[model samples]
Target: MRNINLVLMLLCTTLPVALSLIDGLVPNGDFEEGPKPSQMNGSEVVDPHSIPHWELSGFVEYIKSGQTQGDMILPVPKGHFALRLGNEASIKTKLQVAKGQFYSLSFGIARTCAQQERLNLSITPDIEGKGWGMLPMQTMYSTEGWDSFSWGFFAANNEVELVFYHPQAEEDEACGPIIDVVALKSLSLPKTTTDLLKNGNFEEGPYIFPDTNWGTLVPSNIENDHSPLMGWMVESLKAVRYIDSDHFVVPEGKRAVELVAGRESVIAQIVKTVPGKTYDLEFYVGDAKNLCEGSMLIEVFASNSTFYVPYESKAQGGSKLVLLRFKAANDRTRIRFLSSYYHRKSDFSGSLCGPVVDDVKLVSSILHA
Candidate 1:
């Protein structure tokens, strides 16, 4: 019995390590294994030798967990340690990747000293059509707290060098940006008939709602380039509300999208599709507010065809999935969802109430020659 129990403990410890190896391709990404906290110095620059699985250059500082330097508090975005990139400092690692395959690189970055700091990220062996090359310099300014950022890139060679460097700082001080929780994951290409749209579940976007009263009162509309709903274009004269699982009934993941706060609110995405192929567009439509009277109507437009679907809130408490068939007239198709029905007088809530949408997908229909 004692031996069996020991085996169970070993399995529990080994399972996480095995799963992490499969999920996280980057080694020591969380910076858990590093030099002791006493070795870190605030005034002097440190080398990357103390950190495992990374190569460093220029002036870099290793920040231990719970360590504070002067008025600045060094916080780890993940794990027990993080690296602070001084001006003109960089850290890089070589990764094995398949040529012509796509991958996503994500990391947590925070601004400690300056409001404006920029980092240059690059992948070696530039590929023309695959989009694997030096990424555009990104500027991060998060004085309030740490923020997570991600980018998608294609592998140009079997071995690619992943680099993160802070080229310049706002002032002459050695301080720059703090980085942690680095991760790289390979992405599988969708099949010919699979959906191509990203963030279809409304799960990846601005997480926090602007107004705390969203539980009792609806918030205003959101319409901008970097709107809360990532990978989507929201167009409306009035504001649209971004809903989460805590406040509303999500049809899919922890979050869903609503078309409210405006008379004519629309969310659209342009996707690449095989020309001259028929495709089926599937999505879920429901009522976000129980106070909504009558019925909620939504119009789906794919390519040139349009379909209207309505949902009665009293009949059903949640959402229903609906599918529409359309043909891809060109290589690119504009798929859009528009709120066509709105009755402000019937709704006891003073704000505009409309239909909610979630889990949108578009895939090619099998063709018989």
Candidate 2:
């Protein structure tokens, strides 16, 4: 009888876990319900109860589809409703999460009535001061339409609060970015032999809108250790420009790291590998600006091996992928991409031309015998 009772208790405990995994934790994240046409004017706030499943604070506007407000036309990314948070306004929702499990948060955001729109996102009870993360500021010219952004964080508590608010806004312009299509899902860690580099696609970084439209790494004036590229470091004489799909032909997703801002530049990432094992290194190289007069060169260094590959911008319009095989002599190997070629001093831009790199992947090539 005791064993049967124990079996029943185990079944009860596991059923909830199974159900939670099948359905998302966020309720009404698509904003398909409970968004009345906001009658409030400038700086006027909305009631929290009006929007079901969302806790609102400060001034916010709930706009239905096809609604227009102050030169801003509301278009839903998923359903017939969306949310617009003004400056100093915030929206939050409590979600059930497995403690210490990895989860990803993704949503669609669009700028409205402002140029440099910025938002602060956090999953609270702050874990090691990483609870607060900034959504890369957006600009009018950066995205053609609504763009989806995603981020990953570890759940520190069984119940976590997802909070988003505008951190900065232009003077007198409080209405910031429009948000919709929020999704939160549990994530599984990659296999031990898989590539362990974070932000290998260069998709995670500080996007400085308007000025450069992306993050640029200037050696003498390094903004921060990891702003443009999260898990990489820039060691160069001048600067490394962060290129986006809008301006340049990105090899993979929407962004790539250019090796030159003014002169020679280098980007490196340290990855863990089993010593005495062979690993394969693969990456894409191309011309970011397509304005170089001569051949662009890229030097790749993995562990104890170094190889130089040249690419012609005029011949190959887009990026080309290259693979290199090397043996890991140490537990930690520093994979480096260096642009050493210097353009002629009189060639208009004065040694400012270099190669672009993206879609970097490093994986074990041979299994241990």
What would the TM-scores of all predictions be?
0.56, 0.60
Top lDDT hit: 2
Off by over 4 Å in 1: 1-21, 36-44, 69-72, 129-144, 194-250, 253-281, 285-331, 336-357, 363-369
- Measured with C-alpha atoms, the lDDT of residue 46 in candidate 2 is 56
Residue-level lDDT of model 1, residues 1-369, one tens digit each, is: 999999999997666434432435378887666765554565343656767888888778777777776877876766777888887888888776667756556566676676656666666754543222222212221222454544455567767787888887445556777788777655554333346786787765542322222321111123112333556666554434456677566678876777764345677878997777898888998765545556778888888798989887652337899989888889999988877766452434344556778999877776522
Worst 10 residues of 1 by lDDT: 215-224
lDDT by residue (1-369, candidate 2, tens digit) is 999999999998766445434434257877776644573453244567666778887667766777876675665555687787876788998876677766556566777766667777777753343666665443221223455444555667767788988876556544677788777656554333357676778875433222222333322113222223456677654446566777566789987877753234678888988888998888898865545546777888888998888887762337789988999999999998887676431335333446778988887785543
Worst 10 residues of 2 by lDDT: 218-227
Point to the candidate with the largest TM-score.
2
Clashing pairs in 1: 221-239, 221-240, 222-240
Task: Give lDDT for model 1.
Answer: 0.63
CA lDDT of each prediction against the hidden true structure: 0.63, 0.65
lDDT of 2 at 193: 33
Flag regions of model 2 displaced more than 4 Å. 1-20, 23-25, 36-45, 69-72, 126-129, 138-142, 169-174, 194-269, 273-280, 283-321, 325-331, 336-369
